[model samples]
Target chain A: MKPEQKPDQQTLSSTFALRINGADLVILVLTIMLLFWVYNRLWFKQSSGKADYLVVQIDTQAPVQYPLNQKRLLELEGRKGKSIIEISQGKARFIHSACRNQFCVFHGWLSTPGDTTACLPNRISIAVKSHSVKDTEHFDALAGER
Target chain B: MQLHFTTRHDDHRIALLAALAISIHIIESAFPSPLPGIKPGLANVITLFCFIRYGWQTALQVSLLRVLISSLLLGSFLSPTFLLSLSGALLSLASLYIVQWPFRQHLKYQPTAIGYALIASISHICGQFLVAWYFFIPHPGLFKLLPVFITFAVLLGLLSGIITQLLINTDTAKI
Candidate 1:
């Protein structure tokens, strides 16, 4: 009889395994370097901006309020030219205006950074400016007195 | 006659391997991450196994099939997200293919698997950043959150690697 042939299964599996192992090693090293680069770019280096205060400007031709009150719904109603800025309840917003788009109305209220409302039709704008240190301290003193 | 028979056998082996890789991909996609874009990438473990057990061609097939099938199933086909997945998979596979040589001679399967998994994870993130820059964010500076991405990658990669190592250890023992 011809010499008995040992099954080649082990040889095949081992050969395949060795080839795969080699590929994996190369992938691992390259990935580590890439991750290091991403970490430095995305995480370690970030920007920080300071806080600001709020300002509101309204056109004289626009509607004016004798006295701004939270209790009133503060509707501009049918008045053609008017703008109103109201600050109460620890937040600020343009309560009502005669602008057609009403984007200023949609701005809602602002208590934080970069908040602004503008009625382009009436040439009125309300902006939240970065609060100075003195303003913050004064606000804090007012809170303490209360 | 013997050569033809061996070629047929190799073809069968490759088909079986591809099927196995797709199954793992399905399972990985079915589970959602708590974070919007995170995944354990359990499928990569199988791709790694195939890359180690068969060859680069098989690994490439597995990676492509996994991305295609997973994207289709997840309803992300034809979307930017699908493109991101494809880029990530290709980068990962390329990295794995390149690192296989040193791993075979000097490292145990566990360490090698861990190292490769980490590399794949990083490559995947880089691919994501490229896509985000092109399609979503215009400025590269917007991706300054690289630390957050890297931390997440390390944690997820370590977990995937550990699981893969355990499976490899068990499979080797059976053999």
Candidate 2:
């Protein structure tokens, strides 16, 4: 082929290639989107119900435990620039903190698994662990100890 | 005669264009984003190519077809999400066509790519806002987020344009 013809040939080929690539890209995107939508619609189920256990671990080597009561489970207070963990509602959370974010306070009550309230400034996390009602034996084992 | 016959074959060219465009769309969507409803619009590179190579009509057709196919595949068809995609695609096409027109004479390929990309990004955001206002989110207060959305759009659009420009430049050089 002549040099002049070569440039035109290349251009034609590139154009064809780019066009094919575009079409394939569309098909792939559509397929993925469809799968995601179907999965989200049919399979992704949000959990419901309060957590059975609320675990609050302070910065210490050992985890502090509080009894579960209807009210005043957990509370944290800021004293002299130190975070004080106070379990008031038989659980623990920040009752008062000097931290700027106050994220823990806003976290409110997380009474179920997959629920978490955190105070990032204070490096505090309040989370709930759930036990199913069907697990009555396990529930009794834990509750009996209390 | 042989060269003319090979180049004029419509099936090969059209199929290739459609496939490429769709593939870009898929890739863009597949890449995860931190922010919900934000996309790089990777497929738009093909639309830009179409705009340059074919015409506005072909570009529009490719864009709309990509949106429809992607939405249906993603299972967002006939949903609020589909509407958002459709509106965004239309708006982007309009912007691409508009910008491509006035500057076609003076601007080089890269600059034209950049200009059209920015316009498309802005138009996409506006389309999203309109959809939000009409269908799901009726609150006028949602407009407050426009600046943040636009900023993200600009960044994404620029990146996309740069990549497309690189590809086109490479192709030109090879030719």
Tell me the tens digit of each residue's lDDT in model 1 across A30-105.
6567668766654564324332444544555543432222322333323357666666643567867886778887
RMSD in angstroms between candidate 2 and the native structure over all alpha carbons: 16.1
Model 2 error, position A31 (Å): 34
Per-prediction TM-score, chain A only?
Answer: 0.40, 0.48
Scored by lDDT, model 2 comes in at 0.60
Give the 10-residue window scoring lowest on summed lDDT in candidate 2 chain A: A133-142
lDDT of 2 by residue, A1-146 (tens): 75556777776566544222332344335434644554454346443544455666554434444444444523453232445444434344556666877666666555434455655565555565545533222222113422
For each of the candidates, what fraction of the native contacts does it recover? 0.30, 0.00
Candidate 2 residue-wise lDDT at A131: 50
Interface RMSD of each: 12.4, 16.6
Model 1: lDDT equals: 0.62
Least well predicted 10-residue stretch by lDDT in candidate 1 chain A: A133-142
lDDT of 2 by residue, B1-175 (tens): 3555445444455556767887777777778888777778778788776776667877777777788887777788887777888888888788666656755675443234555566677678778777766556543235445555766776787676666655665554311
The C-alpha RMSD of each candidate to the native structure, in angstroms, is 14.3, 16.1
**Candidate 2 docking class:** incorrect
